[model samples]
Target: MSSLEQANEVYNKYGAYELMKRGISEGLRHLSAPYENLQTEDQWVGAKYYGNFAGFHNNFGGNLAETKCRTASGNPPQIETTQESEELEAAMELRHNGYTKIGNIYDEDVIDEVVSRYNNIIENKEHTKSSHSNDPGDGNVYIRGIDSPQEEYFPEAEQLVTEKVKNILRNYYRSHIQIRNLRAYRTHHIPPELMESKEVYNNHWHCDGKTSDHIKLFVCLGETTEEDGPLHIMPKKYTREYAKRNASFDRETDGAPNNVVEEHGEPVKFTGVAGDVMLANTQTCLHRAGVPDEGRSRDLVQLYIAPSSEPLPENWIDSELEGADPNVWSRLLKY
Candidate 1:
């Protein structure tokens, strides 16, 4: 029989319980080796298969093995310093809730400088790279070149990567971290005709497929109201419950049906002014971009982060950030 057929047969016969058994076994084997001695090939295979299985099991129920391995392998050496009370609280909230937001973290002048640069790019049609299309589109325009500008038109964008933000990320990952990717974007209202046929960028509820340690920092560049298409994210517990009930995995294109929302809690909308920064674990949380009202749009900068063995440098945003794709699973093994 074909591999696909064999896999289906096994899945139909043994289901999730068998998957859990194999996944836990692999996780235990992984824990047997010290983090420093683990092989990259083994880490890759485990992360691609058994790690995903652990995620599947956690969505259906909870998995202690995942947590145990993460803590033992990922935690960094404790440093000596009195962390700011607010940063400490934010870190705690992120750990418990899968997300946290800090308002007015940047000065007005910094916000203006970033916004002005974005406006200039939009007016001049200068950005030639983006996530979806090279040029701006109707639903989303994720400009890619602004962060790595040749002339350094606006240095204030780096203000988004402050020490406080880095501290929060370090605390969340429990290890040294590095920026995986950084870009600015604008999400605009979808035309009514295309709403039914065309998918609005990230409007479908989904969990990122990257490693479980991945998180993102979103910095709003302007006043974001309900009409401006802010983000909506389900709390971690509610997302798990929904996943269990619906057998949802990475993506749910139709979003949570009314029945599911009624059983689970409603998603929280991210609405705030310029200079607001929000940190979210996209790999564990179910979230989607909101569609703006007609003639309205949302502008923001997003920083993707992953765990690393080395401490983040002071000039990380300017010099150390990696490209859009990085060896995330391999990086996880370095802790």
Candidate 2:
């Protein structure tokens, strides 16, 4: 029998879909060779030039004079003494330089109205009832762009994206950063129950792992304290190891894609005040949405940036939302 026919026979014995998935993964590995190291468990793979990990500003740079923080004593400030503390410090420093906070990114009254509208959408009889038994393909609703505030949701968000783009480019200069061929995406959430359980909550760290260029901003509408299930980020150092072990690219066997990160590893959680934004390099940092406690909800506006020069997936729009399974707005982008 021909190889195709023989393979079909094997698939028939096992399972066709599962086999195809594996094949696709293998093929991608061949197409994206240098990035194969990204799929490995070696966290230091990307940190060859940039040392240290974790925290606020890590995705930017390392050992550079600009990336370092000055201590209160006029010495280079060491945010903390532990390994994790150092990582967090680096991340914070990067965030400071790359991202700026525009408090009231939305009008207060308008934000209140929007928040209420979203709350009602979730509390509507259908949404509440479906919560128990249904797994809506893309949540109960999927909005591409908010019509209410066309400026902040799309135009202004797009403008702020410029700064984010600068950050991504600056960091990649010191390391291997590939811009994924995808467009920027915006997402909104108004669910309170999602933050209650680890299993039911937005537990996965979603990303645009396919393309090399990716930087996402998680914008908050309300106070995003621990009660709202603050995001947890695994320092770059840890994720570098993750890239090697989990995100490493492989060759495709048939049509199946390679495996990404496993869902079992522990993730670092994040906490932010209202109006505080989390700027992230999805490829280098592994993060997940926190679970909201009782009577609380999370309202976040997420924006992704992609450069004009890249070739996004033919099904970029649909594929970009791969991680939206649990959280409709969780996704990846490139710029």
Candidate 3:
């Protein structure tokens, strides 16, 4: 059975209160569910006390439901270190002191393993060539994770990078914030050779606010040095000003760019080492990728999560009864 199924069985056998008390008792309080079921109006009202309505892991109970269920929005708290390592400690310090970088979370061998596999895929040259999926050259385009987690590649690190990044988010935001999903994003390549390739493939400055309230964790897998292409992040102070004019965040649509000029006089560039994650507040911050270089490549694994009280879309595809897994697609199509 999948980890999710095992968890559901435990919840069914032991009641939600029991699960909450136990999950909360641990420092892992962030993993506790706010209600037995969020489908009921009463349960949703209770979620307000906890602030926000998005689930922590994106799979609430099982699937998205008006009165039934959906995805989890946070990381699995049980799988964490007894004590944070020095790199994590440094990241916390930097976050506290205004800004900093985390180091060595991924060893050299691990990077080699992922890169080795990533290199073997058919580059998304077609996607890059097509105007429909054209990325502005900020990074390479690739289809990753079809048959991933190959043991020989990085056997010991199944979800190591993902989990570590999630843990950092859990600790930083606390239970007040919910983390939804962590997926390794694959890009073929970014647009042109300009540091100003703001929306290489997609245009305009926007956030994930429409779909969620949680922050986005962007972890760089390859070098993000200046010329190699890095992500551009608008400071928290300028979010509202920019959001006031931008048009689209849904990848299916197109819109105008929200011309954001920082009061500080220059756009902020977020570039870093491999394994470094850019924790962005989706509500206000506007970000874009820098142009990609032929010599320098970029890969990012993103984690998205939100609080559990937010009402899901009335037409979300994952709102079926069986489960959130796409294997239930045939069943969902009937709806």
lDDT of 2 at 95: 46
lDDT of 2 by residue, 259-289 (tens): 2433434554445543445556554555555
Q: Compose the digit string of candidate 3's lDDT tens values, residues 1-335.
A: 98578567757876776455434433232333453244334223322321222222222321332111123333323434445564356336433422234544666777666655444431532212222344344343422332322223223324333445545544543322333444443434443333243344433443332222345556676667767656665554444333333321222232223343333325566677665656665434445555445555556655454433233232222221121121112111211
TM-score of 2: 0.40
Candidate 3 global TM-score: 0.47
Model 1 regions lying over 4 Å from their true place: 1-84, 128-155, 248-253, 256-263, 323-335
lDDT of 2 at 189: 43
Question: Lowest-scoring 10 consecutive residues by lDDT in candidate 2?
Answer: 325-334
Q: Would you give me the overall lDDT of model 2?
A: 0.38
Tell how far residue 161 is off in model 1, in angstroms: 0.9
Lowest-sum lDDT 10-residue window in model 3: 326-335
Rank all candidate structures by their lDDT, best first, as comma-separated numbers.
Answer: 1, 3, 2
Ranking by TM-score: 1, 3, 2
Q: RMSD per prediction, one decimal?
A: 12.0, 15.0, 12.4
Winner by TM-score? 1
Alpha-carbon shift of residue 222 in model 1 (angstroms): 0.7
lDDT of 3: 0.41
All candidates: TM-score? 0.68, 0.40, 0.47
Alpha carbon lDDT of residue 293, candidate 3? 54
